[model samples]
Target: MEKKFNKVVLAYSGGLDTSIIIAWLKETYGCEVIAVSANVGQADELEGLEAKALATGASKYIELDLRKEFVEDFIFPAIKANAKYEGKYLLGTSLARPIIGKKLVEVAKAEGADAICHGCTGKGNDQVRFELAIKAFAPDMPIIAPWRVWDIKSRDDEIDYAEARKIPLKINRETNYSKDKNLWHLSHEGLDLENPANEPKYDEILELGVSPEKAPDTPTYVTITFEKGIPVALDGEKMDGVTLIEKLNKIGGANGIGIIDMVENRLVGMKSRGVYETPGGTILYQAHQDLEEITVDKYTAHFKQKVSLELADILYNGYWYSPLTEAINAFVDKTQENVNGDVKLKLYKGNIIEAGMTSPTSLYSEQTASFGEDDDYNQADSAGFINLYGLPIKMIAKAKEGSL
Candidate 1:
């Protein structure tokens, strides 16, 4: 006999998996299923989700618009840290998971639900991300992952089950490709992406931007202004975080600025090939780094690179709420205190070229770095500096030759 739940709150996306899981939860647990959908800027995907959830037998459906909060809180912090998974991905989907998980736990508590349900599959990293956040917030709440416990094997089986129950679904076997979308990015996995050697059908898969080869021949110039490491203005107009990103997405997408295809290591101990489109996010990341080049010192910048790698790993593994991630973020925030400036970039065919950068606190000195002589510097000082720097190497060489 299956364990019974009085009421279970489910993370619903109105997608193939979650749409079917809502009915399955009600049938298996004999409980009231309350569906919650978090809109983190998945533009068209959120349409009619409430009606669909209710039609599929959910007791209630809740939609939370988290676009502003997602950008200001999650995306900005990751940008400040320069968090990139495996040096390519902008931590788009990885970052969105924790926020969704946290929100789901909040809803579960407010509704006084006995358990929480999710549709993450057994092999994916999302299962870990969702469960870890849930554990962090509500340690004792009963967690139900239907994909792991369900008897359904594949997409075909799921479709058949949904068809037998007459559940309304937009996805079919031929048109089905696993996708996740948020303001920061749109990620595509499974289907033809399962085979590493297969080239992605860009026409069918791309939703945010065009292919690099099809981009316009003429380059576009964009100016972005940052105040203390946070983007404040685009092309002289000040805007809020969400609006700014939206505008940039249009601009960057047209120039083919951010499209990535890679085979990444999942936290669940497997490799998955995914195609990601992150137009605005890629432009912002590059602009931020360009501004930092002038404001941040060499040693701090080098150390932050290591910190960024660690932060990326932390986010990828779903440790967003851990104390270590907090400490690292604090460090990242401190470094950004002086990262204020304007960065002008040229975008063309998926390339981000830094045209110029300026900051009031820049360490660069034109006079000191010039080839001509200056009163502040002496050419004779370098001989002593080189000897001191190479002392260990010279001593080792002398000892080997018995000249010590």
Candidate 2:
């Protein structure tokens, strides 16, 4: 038995999964489906989505241009926290999910829909991310997750369902890799990626950039400017966050930067293997970290390292709308008050080599750090410091020898 609804708002992506979901929701619950797509930098993917959604049984279709907000609110905050899930993933998919979830709720409320639906599968982290964000806004709103209820078992089954229903699909059996794309990154999962033993056919699978072996022989140098830890400029030219990332993606992709393949622990208590291509994100992260090295103090920098781990888990586990996330973000914001600087990086064949870094508020003192004789730091003071630091060791040794 299924609960009845008058209308349902769906977080539609114009993908294989969601394309079938529109028809399924109408068939199962006998409700009118209103499809909403968030344009979060999925270049050219949004084209003809409205017509496709309507043709696939959606009563109405709406596309929200969330590109600017996605960068400013979600992506920039992740950069400030240096949030990397498992210390490797730039959290491209994880970061984008919350914003999309928020938009889905907004559209549902505006359209007077009774429930919200998504294409997230039962086994994936996105199911949690999307649901949690919806819960944050609409606590009692019914979430209709089709993958948990529908009979479609696998990608092959999904393709069959679409074909039988005369639904148009962008992917075929040969190239049916499950993917999530945004301005920040492009992720590839399923197919050969499901088996941990099979090596990812990067040449065949990569969409954002070329393989490192195919990168140009000459290195490309890029200068990134940061204002309070947010990237604002490329090569010394000021630009908005969206434009900056878009430009960097082109440059970084050409140099074969930001490609990673790893097995990650999902929030759902399972391990999944995927390859992520985050060309612009990788460059921004490396450049931001380099600037922080000079601008932030040692204690704050070390503590933020721990915060980075926690923040990574929070974002990956769909706690983006929680109180803990807000508090941690406030702390991260304070740390970035002084994180203003420029970092020059040489990108060559997937390597981000630090060329130079400069910051006006840099804590680094050339005189104190220089090996040559300097009056600012007393080298002799370290002897007294060492004695006091090693006092506990001396006491332990005396006790072991029975020397009172």
Candidate 3:
């Protein structure tokens, strides 16, 4: 049974799955297909995409450049909270999805399309991510996910189909590992990465991050300036969020700043091993954490640690458009109002050393905290303070003994 959708806006990447999906949607549903490629620092990934979409029988092709928007909006906001999934994995691929999905909905509404579609596999988090955003933006709009509906199961079959139609794709049988790249990071999975013990080979298949052994020997210094929790400059030069990040990627990548190979429990089910490259993000996260040590207070600082874990799940499982995410972001924004400062870091091999940190709103008081002849902190206050602090333990010990 073919459901009636007059026009469909497909979240097309011109990749293996989406390339086949464009042709499949045209053949199966008999609907007009409008391909929308989101440029979230993947402009290089869009090489000859327009011609390919046209050859695949798409009615039109649109390439939306969302690099600046992605950094200023999604990437910066997540970094503001210092949100890291599972303590090591930065939510790189995770954060980019909702922004793309949001833009897809906007394009769909503008085009007056009857339905929206994506090439996400049912097993992955992206299917949930894309669908949730679509539902949030247009609850009534129908979504056509080809991977779930199609009879073909593997990338091999998809490759064969593309070959049958003479569709030129960047990936092949040996080279293709499922990947998602954005401004913040690049993710690698769906191949030998399935095995927990298997070490990833440094091949062209994985190019986004540098290997630790291959990194530079010399230490690189980076001074990142921040204004109210947002990174504003690199070294001594003022730069925009996107440009600064790009510069950091080069510096950090050379020094092997961010690379993670972990067996993470997926949001859907089952544990999966994933390799990620988060060059700029690693530096930023380290800098943010360094700044937070001085800028954020003890209570909000500790609480934000717990909130960071929650924010990780919220981002990883793709609830960016939901109310919970909105509330969490609001809370994060409030706490970060005082997170203004600069962090100096020394990058050597795989280690990020915090050189120094300075913030206008810093709570570190020399008068109260310094050991060098501080007048404000009287020695007498500590005598009663220690008794009060330890009273509960003291009472418990005395009651247990017969001295209460």
Candidate 4:
């Protein structure tokens, strides 16, 4: 007798692993499988996913549009904090999984699934990301991961199994590198990138960003408007979150703005090299940081940038479900209370330069700031203020003199 599962919901992407797991789950557990995919700006990657899931023996398939929520809820919050991992990475893939996982639980409950299955390999950060979300929402639900439980050890083995079973392989077998793409960014990993000596092939590795050499000669002047820390307009045109990103992407891509290549440490304990294209995200991040510089106070602004690094680590390491992340987000929200303004940026080739910023809450007064013509500052007032501020230095000097 087969160990029974009445129904299972899988976070299906219609990728190699997910495609294979759909058939395996039916064979192993003898259960009805429901495939659910979250559309977090994956573009055409999601095309034919529903038909493919049904072809692989799924009882039903559900695809929900989450691009707006992904931007407003997850991406905007991170942008408000200016979260970037390792001072270079933008955490594009990091913050996307939680939204995907949260959707999995909701679908599973509606479908009456006895368990939730995921296509994530045991060694990667996604397995932890997916499972933690399942645990948080449905603690008692049985979790199944095929890579951990099954005997398949390599991609070749998986392909062999797929071929014999007649499941059409979507990815070309000869293409060694794996790529993940979405509206926010696209990432390339494995194969030639695994070697540090090899420079990435420009022709095969890009989608959004243009080659620097191919970029137009003129610098692009762009303006972004934000309200209460969320981006609302691009280049003076008031647009929704989705439309705004798409427009900026066109401009940034033409100018080669957001292209990143680096070797980063994976949460699973390995050094991996990857190339990323974040055209729209790069522009938005630059605009957000520029706004913060003018709107936020000195102490809060500096400290929030520091907090951003920690936030990047958590999001990248799949710790989005922890208490620390909640606390950090609360702190970030408080800091963003004044992060509302318009930022003018000069975009040239691959650079994002801050031109100027104007905010109603700006502490910058021309009379106080300008040395050429400033009536607000009394020159005599500085003498007493400096003396009071330097008192500790004087005390330390006196103490040293007495000891000597």
Candidate 5:
């Protein structure tokens, strides 16, 4: 017995899984399959995707150019929140999912489709990210996740099925690394990365840039300008969010600015090893932090650190549109109001060194912190302040001395 629907809009990537998914959707459910690809700066990945979808039996294929929107909408907000999963991973793949899922919902509604489909597997966090976004946008829309329902068990099994159906694929058995690329980052999982003991073969697997060992000996200098915590310019050239990120990717990659390998706790209660390349993103994060140090007050900066942890967890767990995320973003936006500044960074063989930072809203005062200041201070005033501040320690020391 075949389950039937009028139409289903699939969040397609033209990758191995989705290429096979389009045919499976048509054969298993007898529904019209519409493939939608959102271009979020995945340079070569979008090539021939439309024709590929159609050849794979999709009734229609729609590719949306979402690079600018992805950066200004999703990327900037995460930057403002300073969101990082487990303190190293930049949440690159995690951040892209919501925008892609949101676009799928829009396409499904416009096409008058009753269902939305994805190629995410049962064990992965992406399934939660995609389905949650779908449920958020269109609660009644049916979600047809082939990995969860179908009998296909592994990538080898999927490859065999694709071969049997005569579907063309970019991936084969030897290409072991599963990758996801967007403007912000490129992520690699599977293959040797499945084992924690196995070191990532960076020389072979890296797509965006060379490893630090292979980077040039000469250091590179770059200046980044931010307004309200969003990066607006790089190296004194003003550009849009997408352009700035793209330019930095090239500059940072040349100098080996960002590369991370970590074993992270997945949302599904399992550990997964992933290698992420975030060349431009790493520079931006370092620059933003430097600017914030001068512009943000101590208390607010401390409090925002706590908020950043919550924001990172929400993003990694795929709650981008939830009320809690909205609230935290609202708070983050308020903090960025004063975070306007320019930061100069020295990129050298995978190290982001803070060269300098300046802000009109900077809370630092040379006169107040100077050692030889003559005005507005009494040298004896520190004695009273120290006594009050250390009263508890002083009392504890006296009690111990008396007992001895």
Candidate 6:
């Protein structure tokens, strides 16, 4: 005996897993499946999705253009917090999951669907991310994770299942790397990437940019303007967040910027190796940091480093809607109040070299920092300060000498 539902709303992507999931839901539950796909800047992937979903036994297909919202509400906040998982990953997939999950709940509630479904696998962190978000919004809503319950054990098994039913797949055995793409980044996992010792064949798998060796000979310069820690312009041309990122992606990619290969610890207690391309995001982060260096004070900047690490863990673990995350964002927002400035960067051979930075609220005073005579700082005062700081050390040395 098994539970039954009259209708289910699935977080659909029109990818191989979700494509087969639509049919599986129909066959297993004998219910009307509404496929909801959120377009978080996955270009070309959403084309003809409605017709495909309907033809594959879905009762309805809903595509939501969430690009602007994703950038503003999710991505920008992560930037302000300088959120980086393990101080390496820019959290491209981590940031997109909550918004997508929020949309799934909304569609499910509107359609009066009995449950929400997703194609996230049990082994990956996405299942936790998706379900946590779903639970936050709709506490009682049942979540059907196909990868957990289904008999399919591997990607090959999924391909076989699709072939048995004549379902078309975008990837095959030869090029079956699992991927998740958004405006911020494109990630590649599985296949050769599963082995940590194997060097990634970037030329074959990279969709976002060229490798450093293949980059252009000339260095490309980009000036990013930030207001309250949010990127507002590139090369002095004012634009919205989405447009700014899009433009930088082109420039950074052409200059061979923002490619990373790492083995990250997943929330599921396992390490997974993946290669990520985040051209635009890397540039924005570097520029933002450059601005903060001049604008933010030493004490606050040091504390924010710890906050960045904590925030990264929270976001990576799918606690976006939690109270602690909200509080951390509030603090981060306050810090960004004076983070207004410009950073000029030189991109060449997979490096972001800071050419210059300027800020109206800069704490750096050249006269005070100079080695020459300065009226603001007295050299004589440091002797007294050092004596006070070294009091404990002096006492310890005296105590040992007396015994000798």
Best by lDDT: 2
True-structure lDDT of candidate 3? 0.87
User: What are the per-residue Cα lDDT tens digits for candidate 1 across 1-404?
Assistant: 99999999999999999989988998898999999999999989999899999999999999988888899889999988889999998988888888899999999999999999999999999999999999999999999998899999998889998999998888889988899999999999988999999999987888888888888999999999998889989988999999999999988988887999999999988899999999999999999998898899999999999999999999999999999998998999999999998899999999999899888878877789999977688989999999999999999999999999
lDDT per model vs. reference: 0.92, 0.94, 0.87, 0.85, 0.91, 0.93
CA shift of 269, model 5, Å = 0.5
Model 4, runs deviating above 4 Å: 1-3, 391-404
Stretches of candidate 6 off by over 4 Å are none
Give lDDT: candidate 3, residue 325. 88
Which tens-of-lDDT digit does each residue in 172-194 have in candidate 2? 99999999999999999998899
As a TM-score, model 1 comes out at 0.98
The residue-by-residue lDDT of candidate 6 on 1-404, one tens digit each, is 55899999999998889989998998888889999999998889899899989988999999999999999999999999899999899999999999999989999999999999999999999999999999999999999999999899999999999999888888899899999999999999999899999999999998888999999888999998889999998999999988888888888887779999989999999999999999999999988988999999989999999999999999999999999999999999999999988899999999999999988878889999999988889999999999999999999998989942
lDDT of 3 by residue, 206-318 (tens): 46657777788788999998887899999879989989998998888888879888888788997888888888999999998899899888999999899989989888998
Query: Candidate 4's error at 155, in angstroms?
Result: 2.3
Model 3 / residue 361 / CA error / Å? 2.1
Clashing pairs in 3: none
293-312, model 5: which lDDT tens digit per residue?
Answer: 98999999999999999999
RMSD of 2: 1.0
What are the runs in model 5 whose C-alpha is more than 4 Å off? 399-404
TM-score, cand. 6 vs. native:
0.98
What value does the lDDT take at residue 240 in candidate 2?
99
Q: Which residue runs of candidate 2 sit more than 4 Å off their true CA positions? A: none
